[model samples]
Target: MGKKRLVSLLLAAVMLLMAACSVNMGEDEPKTTTDPGTKGTETKSGAQKVVFWHAMGGATTKVVDQLVDNFNKSQDKIQVEAVYQGTYDDLLSKLKASMGTSEGPTVVQMYEIGSRFMIDSKLITPMQNFIDQDKWDVGQLEPNISGYYTFDDKLYSMPFNTSNPILYYNKDLFKEAGLDPENPPKTFEELKTAADKISKTGKAVGANFAIYGWFMEQFFANQGAEYVNNGNGRDDLATESLVNSEAGVKVMTWWKDLIDSKAANNLGRKTDDSKKAFSAGQVAMILDSTAALKGLVDGTAGKFEVGTGFLPKPADAKEGGVIVGGASLWMMNNRPDEEQKAAWEFIKFLTSPEQQAFWHINTGYFPITTKAYEQDSVKENLKKFPQFQTAIDQLHNTKLNRATQGAVMGVFPEARQIVEGAIEEVLNNKKTPKAALDDAAKEITSKIQEYNRTVK
Candidate 1:
């Protein structure tokens, strides 16, 4: 053979061997791309983002965002986007519409009581499942607060902004009334007497309160009144509302006398308006949620030293329980496996004690995790600021009372409106407390009955 022909054959043989090797490597490795610029940080889900829906606003949002930022930076697994969806009602509406829809958020912040309905819907995964599946230590959480997102034997959500109401006072007004500013009102009578003295000052209203239904619920629980008939809103089988009972009526009557004797003023009942009234020195003492600490601090802004204490009890009020308030985080139903994994990762990140501490310290949301309270940073913050210390103290010995279990009647918010409307009538001198609550309770019963029928 000629030399040129032999060389050509050898070149073709080498080319064919190389092509065969390429085919085998392609089959074994599938396909993937690595950018040198990405610097070894895996995309985890490759640009996937999680949507978190919450009702937190103002400073609360700032606190939440900081936590979200921390989670994103800690790992690149998934990015979370939080949207303020008005109120819990508005979020419920969106959740109802999103059921089984593909466009909903992976996470939704729900009212603690309303979680019962969500649990029944089977539209979300229980947080306990995640904890166990991931081999998480439940002990890291505060025991009593665990049930905030739980129902029966399963937990459908994770406690986010859990809080309970407490008595907030204007210390300057307390001193003016010859009362010890540090020694706050301890019972309904003490509150009234201090209020009476403050009212006599002509500058301070004796007592201040907001949300009649919330007050009735809190006061009744404080008065040892059963809220639900069977076992005070504990059992799911409860068939009647006991809020219209003798104990309930008595508390309402006392509140009426405050208005009647002109020892107290409603001054228009809203959480914000009430805070403003108290901070501006229009009222001496206000019963509000410890969650209102931020607003109270902001409104006072060095105007007067403020003091905090647990909600006043009656001399005979139940000494052991106050129900939980605030909302929780829920994972929506039927997401893709990847999406579910991503969502669960995000949920775990947010519920961790470190994140809870960050939230509690910054936004006044009670730390859902126990470790947050025990942190040196949290302790330092509490000592540096009495406002923070008060809320912390309230939680130190709180009992998980069923009497204040929380309002779950579907039209509960509307029922509150009914009571507020009746309150207006009394505040306007159009009806007595008996007359007002009578009108209010009747409407509430109808609404409860109406909501009950729909649920069943």
Candidate 2:
């Protein structure tokens, strides 16, 4: 062979190797296409990929994972990836940072108070759009639960895990204090009386209500009081805070008086701490979400009998109901049409009667759909935990009103923090209840105004 022939053969071999490398690299890369709708990347299997960010932790996380796995395995057209994003606050913070970017989730499970902020962000495709497009029956869901997420006759999000506040008391302590074990306190005065009597028995503190801001909101609603103006921020955007109104004064006064009279103990702001105290029999009564029922029951098993009752109100306060407290699933508009539709499918699966029944029984959160009650599993679970009946009855007995509908404000998360700080101030004797609440209301109103300006 000649020298020129050898050099040409070597050059051709080098070129062929480079071409092979390029082809391999192309195959290894993800197959993604950018469209006008920001459609997500398709998997190698040709399935649409949907990312779901949720705040569910502990055992509930396992349930969520299992549900997602089931959905992924049930079909091959779409695949969902569930990611735990710490607390709801953490998730929202990350979401805010990821807005207008591909890093954000296709679906996010945000706490109920974040509804106004989510809507104002204009980043989400209102769940109502999908419902209307599909001609789905919205009536199948619990009206009370749906009412919270509905604004201007539109549903912005799908209610996933729904709950409300309830009073959990140790029936044995009531009996020991010479009070009726079966009849729990229904009014604030009665609660105070019971707390005083139970505390005097030396069994445990009469009550240990956590200094959580959510409790303050619920208390206001229980008194048929709106937390903000503009019809609880439902009729229109709320411009002011009503946290220092007459109803607010009554709640703060009664709460402070209870602690001052040694009828109840303030357990700081962490609800988990108070729940642990109750489970350890260190407190006779406590206020908590209905969602905690299962954990509380199991934690106190074989130790004491737990009795549940309605959230108490001022004796003279007209009959008002508790507000629904929980999170919802939001579909982001930044996702592609196919990905958004896939996320919607997952949302529907999560709210289905069977899935909702399982979720309710396992987590103690109310199934957003009323049809879940018809499931045998739900019925059996209710029979096993009769105390849960109070939650159901309370939800049904609640009249649909502005107070019960709950407040909506873009600054709700910040407002909650402010309210929590004011509560701590009052509890620590650093300020008068009126003074602290007034300051909090002012701060919250200012934040709301800022949010409004930014959105506009």
Candidate 3:
């Protein structure tokens, strides 16, 4: 059988098994009830110490520490200790090794995709109960953010440091190329033309991207294609994937071309390396998480300048919506109920509009709440960097479609590796775009089946 036929057949078998298998997240009734304004458990006089593990570094980390201090001083009941626990993968390893050992922190920052393993392990407690008991109404929060924490119909974590990808460029390079720095590319053909012009300048080598997987997702989502099935992404609320399709293949092929022409340098298999190259002005345009802007500007400091723009689209592409990235706060199990209460306080504090405004200013992240944007302090901060609106505009332009359901497969990082390898083949001229992605789809499907086998 051909690779396509074999993969389609494999998908059929897996779909059949999926139909036969049934897994329940939890019971039907809500687990905990609430009481208004009552202090149930009191460790009077001395505040409870809640240690939180996160991946933020430098300026971002400093701001979190200040928030912790602000929260501690605001109330007499909780004291939060925030720790810079290596990277996301690093925290995953630490979290796994320390399981049931009783030596780990009370709360940890987990990337959205990695939350599932912890959720399944029963290592992290559902936080809704605590919120409910505290008489908190979650309905008041942003709906888009709720999915990030809701797993199995319950809240397992708190959304923090959330960000979506956007296009970044060096304006100086654009001017040198004789292209309007203010007139950023709005469609695919224009993007191609602008890139070619910028590359000719030799001041910087054309456009490059840090997160190819994320770039593919935004490119397709903007076209109204689904990356995965379960509700636009692995929101932990959806039940399927959408990685194999015509639109998906098209998006992959697009990136494969960039890799092929060396238009964008290899992300070098390491995000830091690509980021360094961009900051050093080795690459003219890049698509990276907006969360990196503050650092990029900080690193470039007087050497060159940076500019922001929305992702360009193909002429036929539909509106776009990207799966959110960064990390969320998962409340770990094993801590006493009182400790969980303290942790709940920390979660609420981190997400408040006042703190959100402070954080957006300090770290250059988009505000999570509508109110944050309207704040006077936020208004003043907006002048220096009007590009903050770029993220909002990007989010607003998104339209719901099958293409927007961002793909979520188990062992996502591994699946990404398979995808990266497939693109490598295209870039290296080993095969045509169609053939490369067809083989990639087959390999991806096989891995999905393998992951499914381990699940049950």
Across 319-373, the per-residue lDDT of candidate 3 in tens digits comes to: 6566566667888777888898788878887778898999889876666666777
Q: Using lDDT as the measure, name the better of candidate 1 and candidate 3.
A: 1
**Predictions: Cα RMSD each:** 18.1, 14.2, 9.8
Error of 1 at 328 (Å): 0.3
TM-score of each: 0.83, 0.88, 0.80
Alpha-carbon lDDT of model 3? 0.65
**What TM-score should be assigned to candidate 3?**
0.80
How many backbone overlaps does candidate 1 show?
A: 1
| Candidate 2 TM-score over all chains jointly | 0.88
In model 2, residue pairs whose N, Cα or C atoms come closer than 3 Å (at least 3 residues apart or on different chains), thus clashing, are none
RMSD of 1: 18.1
Give me the overall lDDT of model 2.
Answer: 0.82
Residue 205 CA displacement from its true place in model 1, Å: 1.7
Candidate 2 ranges beyond 4 A from true positions: 1-44
> Candidate 3: which stretches are off by over 4 Å?
1-45, 134-140, 151-154, 201-203, 229-244, 258-267, 298-305, 400-405
